[model samples]
Target: MLVVYTTTLFMISLLIIDYSTYVLEYPHSFKYNMVKNK
Candidate 1:
């Protein structure tokens, strides 16, 4: 039971970090595309 709880917490934290990274990277990606167009 403790193992299961710890795994769940780890997965949740991983998901949050993954989403925040994507949010940050997406803007940089968009700017890169805009620059390429010009």
Candidate 2:
């Protein structure tokens, strides 16, 4: 039970990290392209 709980938490954290990075990077890439065009 403990192992299962830990694994679930780890998976959740990984997903959250991935989602946050994607959110953070999306605008960054857009701005980068905008700057490149200018």
lDDT of 2 by residue, 1-38 (tens): 99999999999999999999999999999999999999
Pairs with backbone N, CA or C atoms under 3 Å apart (clashes), candidate 2:
none
lDDT of each: 1.00, 1.00
lDDT of 1 by residue, 1-38 (tens): 99999999999999999999999999999999999999
Model 1 collision count: 0
**Ten-residue stretch with the least lDDT total in model 2:** 23-32
In Å, residue 21's CA in model 1 sits off its true spot by 0.8
Candidate 1, residue 16: CA error in Å? 0.8
